[model samples]
Target: MEYVEHRMNDEAVKAAASAGLVSPLNILLLSIILYTGYSTFFAKTSYPQLPKPPPPVVFKTYNPHTLLPFNGENGAPIFFAVRGVVFDVTPGRNFYGPGGPYANFAGRDATRGLACGSFDESMLTKDLDGPLDTLADLGPDEMDALRGWEERFTEKYNIIGKFVSMKDFEELGKKE
Candidate 1:
């Protein structure tokens, strides 16, 4: 039992067990890994931008409902359109209810335009909150709005196909 060698080769050193304490080599390796992650993630200074949206296109229309439009008085009509999609552009819609208050512009002719403004039951509120609620909560014009909404939202009501247009939406609303 008298064969005590001294120096270990590089291969043997690499195979040696790690010490119970931290080492400079380990710290350097960890720092390198952390820095790589930081540079890849947090240091992202630029990225490929998304395509710019198309320019706005005006397509105005008339609204002759009892409820006033945006920034307009009650019973006054409003109109404005841009980017192929149109909006009431009328301010203070507190007077018009969803279906009749403001005029939404959506087309299905040949362009298959996007779904424009629409009335939904979810927008109703209990009790009156002034003009907004008064118009929104009333049921006097329920028949007209319901009919118009039905025709526009009943074109597409299946999962097997995609929605063709706003005109093709489901008319599964409650029956009168």
Candidate 2:
């Protein structure tokens, strides 16, 4: 009986000693380490990953009849009517030189080349010559047709210049 009581007392003493040895300072140190680690990682500021969209495209256009050497009947002109306006396009070429580089007439944007042009800009520039070709006898309708096409074109492209038509061409010769 006494031996059993002594063994139990010894076990109780060992348990008490182990429980008492739980140092508050050690517990505080462990808590601080855990808090610092959590704050440094999970509690800190974070940013989300997102995708970026591509830049917008710009369009370009040219007026017909401002250019030279316009086509006649290798094919007739292709006339376009839109928004109460009329336009005629005759296929041909005009010599570009000096300040007007071939690439610029092609709408290459000089610095950026073909890549700089929009889908419409690039498409329109295909086989297009210069202000001379663009202006060459595209067609003549009522002045209102010119106005509508001009308005539609201006919506897409910047109108850099105007055409000196065949009438002006004859007038120039008469003047000089």
Candidate 3:
């Protein structure tokens, strides 16, 4: 009778262990389902917003003297004149700023240099008050090259202003 009672007690213990294991598994599955439902039906998802771009720059007129300061010096914007147009080349500061390969053209007329494909200082006009380069001596090939450069400039940089002689600038100021 003692042996029979011991066997019965062992069977009861095994049954309890199995029931405990199944209860935990069922509770885990129920918790997962509840969490899934809560997230799908009630939880709000959010995403970060992007910043707006800056407004367009207003166009201004500049002459050789007035355009001289925008040479990427002292934190100034880089500017260069091409075919009587002043372009804000600040975006290309690495190429047109001080210590740059094309720095000689900054704050000066770059037409002759660009047309001749020369980055020499001689290509730049020395006199600020002097008349603009006529570019009359440029051959057809040079003219075409200059046009190509102008188109590239137009596509890359902002046309911030017009390049004019000091005389013309003065006349414009007087008229205004």
Candidate 4:
């Protein structure tokens, strides 16, 4: 009789486990589901990295007289200069075209204006004729701002060429 009773208890425990009632396997399944839910719904994830691009192919140098013609005139591509770097801003013609807010900046190297956060035409200059000391007026904060603009332009646009002074143009013309 004692042996029969022990066997009956064993059978009852096995039946409870098979019925998915309080059992080790059931507890483990619940734990897995909870963990999966927590990870999927609550865990923080980092941003994915962007792919690297190839080096840009730079075109010949450009002067303000040459760069100005691409100002969306008669379906021409719009262009702009920043800190001696020229960008084809045709893609954003509505924002940089004639009569646009930044229209004054389209044909000029407005580095000083950008650095100082001034839209004054006086700050814009295409003639980088003077010595490097011309930029001595910029403070550290202004320089930082200028660097930020250049970085943003590099990331966003295709750099075509650099701005050239009349003196440099003359020298290159003589060479060619």
The per-model lDDT (C-alpha) reads: 0.34, 0.39, 0.92, 0.77
Error of 4 at 33 (Å): 49
State TM-scores per candidate: 0.20, 0.21, 0.73, 0.61
lDDT of 4 by residue, 8-76 (tens): 999998897688766778899999999999989999978898889755665868876777677776777
Give candidate 3 misplaced runs (Cα > 4 Å): 1-46
Q: How far is candidate 1 from the true structure (C-alpha RMSD, Å)?
A: 17.6
Winning candidate number (lDDT): 3
1-176, model 2: which lDDT tens digit per residue? Answer: 99999999999999988876687977888899999999998995768968786344322122333332222223323232222122232121121221222312331221112122222334233432332223233434433454554565546443333333345445666888
Q: Model 4 residue 149 lDDT?
A: 86
Where does candidate 4 stray beyond 4 Å?
Answer: 1-58, 126-133
Model 3 agreement with the true structure over 22-42: per-residue lDDT tens digits: 897789999999999999999
Cα RMSD for candidates in order: 17.6, 14.8, 5.9, 9.0
Error of 1 at 83 (Å): 24
Would you give me the overall lDDT of model 4? 0.77
Off by over 4 Å in 2: 1-5, 45-176
Clashes of each: 11, 13, 0, 0
lDDT of 3 at 81: 95
- Error in Å for residue 139 of model 1: 41
Which ten-residue region of model 1 has the weakest summed lDDT? 106-115
Q: What shift in Å separates residue 7 of candidate 1 from its native position after superposition?
A: 6.9
- Cα displacement (angstroms), candidate 4, residue 17, comes to 61
